[model samples]
Target: MADVDQVRPRQAASPSMTARQRLALGLLLSAGFTLAVDFSILNVALPGIGADVGLPLDGLQWVATAFALCAAGFTLLFGRLADMFGRRRLFLAGMALLGVASAAGGLATSPAALVGARAAQGLATAAVTPAALALLTTSFPEGPHRDRALGLNGALMAAGFTAGAILGGVLTDLLSWRWAFFVNVPVAAAVVAIAPAVLAPDRLGRRPRLDVPGAVTVTAGLLAVVYGLTAAGDTSWGDPRTVAALAAGGVLLAAFWVIESQVAAPLVPVTVLRRPGVRWGNVAGLTAFATETSLVFLLTLYLQKVLGYSPLVAGLSFTVLGAGTVLGGIAGPKVIGRIGGRSAMVAGFAVQAAATLTLVRLGPEPSWTALLLVATFAGGVANLVAIVGFMVTATSGLPDREQGLATGLATMSQQVGITMGIPIMSAVVTARVHGLGGQGPGAVLGGITTAIVVNAAVCAAMAIVAAVFPRREALTQVPPAAPPGT
Candidate 1:
């Protein structure tokens, strides 16, 4: 990838956007927030849904897995479709589908029905998310304005995930788990109702042939990989079924690369992945997302199981993190404006690494008043900064035609990191506890601390990687075009 100093600098005289453009950006950000919320909203609702629908634990796990499989699997396909057809049309369709799916999930009477509804929600998210991102990147010219917009987008996305954890628990306790899914209905309806008026229509471009084989292979591969990873959490990673699924997924993905090399219009062109910025930025994004999420997952367990806090109280404690995330989001653009994307990203990673290291002080009798709260808040802020910086760098130099692919790759990296992180980290915690050889509080604390130390090491490694990345000056410099296609 090009280093920060290598890209052409933005012209001193940057043009301003109209009021309609600002409104369009707001609508798109709202869409992003809802989709992010939907990703995690069902997590806390799992136990309740399982009881109501008479699902065993294995079946219950699939309730969340089903959504992830479809969402992560189909995102590239929908991203390409948006490029072929129209982003606005796809966005509206996705919103409609999500509204319907949310309602179905809310009213589901059987496990099959709920799982199917969750899958539908995932498919809808695949469409809605990439379209919204592509639209935003194309709508705003790349400069300080786009940087600020993306900062808010990254903020809302992180905020939504954090908020969902708390909101899901609240809704499940006060009303019903069903209300968690139901909550998206009105939000989707509002966005769908207003989108047409605020967003500009895409002009007809030469549509490419849909790469069906590539899409099928990739989708199947992702499904298998996600299933394997999810299974590894419950059963041993050495389990035959888990091993088989992972191997199959690898084969399919290898086959997908072969198909892409020969196809007329590949779903994800190999050339796109070859870009240094895109490749490294996604690597940074995946690392940041995985480490941050793993930290949160371990924190929740420590608070509830080890420290004897209620689920609701543990969830509410994240408010400090949430506050820091929002503030960090607001500050990210300014940081980028000063230091540039690469430097900002490296700094973010460094901050988060330091924050994670602080949590190594965690003990059997925790000090929530000082150490825990400070580390949590710092991690949140650093996470948002890294996220925004990685996103900005990844998609920085791409043209409008490739915006969908760029955003799709960025989003996919995040999903894959999250889907894989928890299981892997949980396994680490489990092995550590087993080695320590006791169920006592001290042993439990040792295990949690060990897992966090691993997370800290990962963060530190990513920071080193980010620091060593070659400068790509093209990322900071804005193109002269005022509109997307020009």
Candidate 2:
């Protein structure tokens, strides 16, 4: 593995170049914003989409799952690509592809076509995410500056989720569900224009052989695992398709690991995974995101179905949770800087778990208390706080040269969290919600409560693992401010 500190690039973005640098950062964040918009915006629009596309409930879930599965599968692939080629090149390519795919999704002819387009859109993200993060991490000095940048990046997701929920409802009600994708076109166009001018050009490091076989294996493995979990809600565990996807996923991933261990130019450096901080960060992120994302998924559905909310109201209902995440993401760095990363992570986890517990008391009847929303919102905020801390902690130790790959593995874990969350929670909910005739709302509420409780348990477990976070390093206040090499 490349030594991170040695390879960390110094920022030439200076007094005169501050505007350009900020623009570059903003554009990079736009990529994140676009992703967030897609992620949650679909939650509110699913009903309209299903109606337009003539999809059943299970098929409707696929609309979302397909994007996540493909996105998660390709996360490492793009990460490796950025490492092999150039991070900036891939970033630009990803933007172009994302824009094109977004347009295509808006124009999709059939449900299958839309699903295919969404998957293509997911692939674009696979390219942009790691590369964009690498650029920011390598561009700045590791301190308050970089921390603020990361915080802003985290804030984008919260803001984007808020936008998505509201926009999803507004578009579906006033215009068309396709407007969600259409919205990205103008934003992406603006970014593409400024990116090359503002962002530093990509420079390739060690030209390691691309691990095509390993990439294929891991991709297949992730796809299988995600598919199996997603199908668990609609298909029996005994079903042949479910079994094959899961088994194949397992075999492919195992083979990939074996191949990686033996190969000199492995796609994912084994050493990085062995690093205590990196390993635990991934574990913590995966579990935390899974629980939190599942709550969003299950509750969004229930708000619409059980609570009898329109898409607009359901989306607004999520706004409270989105606001909490934004606040958490924005404030996380300051807290970390004052105390430390570990403390912030653990404290944030506590807040999130407490928020999850708050959701357990939700019922079939509406309450104006706002505690549920506030608690869930706090959980969302805590999520960003913890995850961003995890990112800083995980990547801080790596040398500048390998930041792209490091960012890849780190970001991919979040994708895995979301991918796994939906299916597992759905399956559990469906199983329990059955056999309740005429008490549909009660059944749905029961399922949602169970999922949130499980999510809470996941957060609690994360707190335990966080206790083992390596020696307290004063967390970076802003990742983008870091000197190229920490």
Candidate 3:
């Protein structure tokens, strides 16, 4: 097997770039934003979709789960493929697939068709996301330039979720929920149209090889694990299918590790996992995503179910969150430069923990505009800070050849965090509510508060974990080179 340094190019991007390069950056950012938007857009539109297609509640759950499973399962494989083939090629192809899937989803007449389209869209997203990040990392030198670009990228992606939630509600109310899916078709079409001319193709020194066994086992394992988690939330962890799925997933993952050890060219190189940055960065990423997403999910329910806020009002209330995130994104690079990535990440987690704790004040009847929005804004800022910090720390110092791998790992951590968080926390809420055995609004408030308090404690623990992160220089150190002449 070739060393990473052997496969990577030595030349760095010039600090100054041409107009076309800037356009390429814009397109890449747009692609990432679109991916984020698509994921969240369906959140608010699920009820409408269920009604339209006559989908049972159980089937509707799969609409989101199917997408999450496919995206999480295939992301690493596609990331490696991007490194092997061409980032530009995979990116364009992914965009094309996304567009087609979006159209199919918009035009779906049956439940299976819609769910299948969503799964296809997720697969395409898995392909596009890491490739886009790799492209961005390669396009700029590792310094303030890259930091600034990454910050902006982080901000836009974060903002996309907020925008999607709002847009989904509006589209579902004003027109039809189908428009939520239809919306992506045009943005993707535009990206496909412009990407080829603006973005440069990656050059490979040698033909790439695939670890088919590793890929198959890992993907299947992830799918099974996600399915089990999703099932556990709806049913019980003791359910036969859930137990069987979890057990099979564990065995498959263990088999994957053995396969990876023996493979000449493994899908995920063991060396990658050995890197301090890759390891801790992913841990921090998972914690940040899980805690933040859980808080938002719980708070959204609190606002709508307990407070009886309209969907539009609930969506609009996130303005503080969106604005704070954008501000934090603009400031993230400067903060990281001053305090270092480790410190920034630690601080970010601390802020997030504090914000989540503040939400514990939520009650059956409380003011929505003041205290709730303030906490949301703080959480939003911390989110941007945490995301940018983890991203830079994780991907930094990775050779050109491994950029895809680094980004893939980071993105997968995030996906897994979100997928795991919602189900686990929802189960917590369910159990708490069931234990209270009350059919009143007060019981709902008590349950939500209890669950959120647990979330806060988790965030605090995550912050301490972040505090112990490796130094920036050590985290970003390049791997040792191969012998003089391969």
Instruction: Report the lDDT tens digits of candidate 2 across residue range 1-486.
Output: 222222333334334426766887778888888887787677677877888777777688777777888778888888878877888899888888888888988887688888887888888878888888888888766656676677788777656856777888888788998998888888778778878888888776568788888888988898888788777656766778888888998999999999889888888878877765677767777876777777777777777777787667776787777787788778987876765566667777888898788878777767723766877777888888887777766666677778888889877887788778877888777766774543477788887777778778878878877764443321332246667767
Q: Encode model 1's per-residue lDDT on 1-486: one tens digit a residue.
A: 444533744525456767998899889989888888887777777888899988887788888888888888788778888888988899999999999999999999998899999999999988988889889888877888778788899888888877888898899999999999899899899999999899998885888888999999988998888888888876768888889989999999999999999998999889878666788889988887788777778888888778888777877888888887888888898888887777778889889989989888887575653688898889888888888888888888778898988988888787777778888888888888899998777777788889898998888888788777534423433457688675
- Residue 85 displacement in candidate 1 (angstroms): 1.2
Top of the candidates by TM-score = 1
Compared with the true structure, the alpha-carbon lDDT of candidate 2 equals 0.76
Residue 356 lDDT in candidate 1: 89
User: Model 1 segments beyond 4 Å from truth?
Assistant: 9-17, 470-486
Computed on alpha carbons, the lDDT of every model, listed in order, comes to: 0.84, 0.76, 0.83
Find the 10 residues in a row with the least total lDDT in model 3.
1-10
Clashes of 2: 25
For model 3, how does the per-residue alpha-carbon lDDT over 154-270 read when each residue is reduced to its tens digit? 888778877888888899889998998899899999999988789986688686689999999999998888888888877887889889989999999999999988889999998
Ten-residue stretch with the least lDDT total in model 1 = 469-478
Global local distance difference test of model 1: 0.84
Listed per model in order, the count of residue pairs whose N, CA or C atoms clash below 3 Å is 15, 25, 0
The 10 consecutive residues of candidate 2 with the worst lDDT sum are 1-10
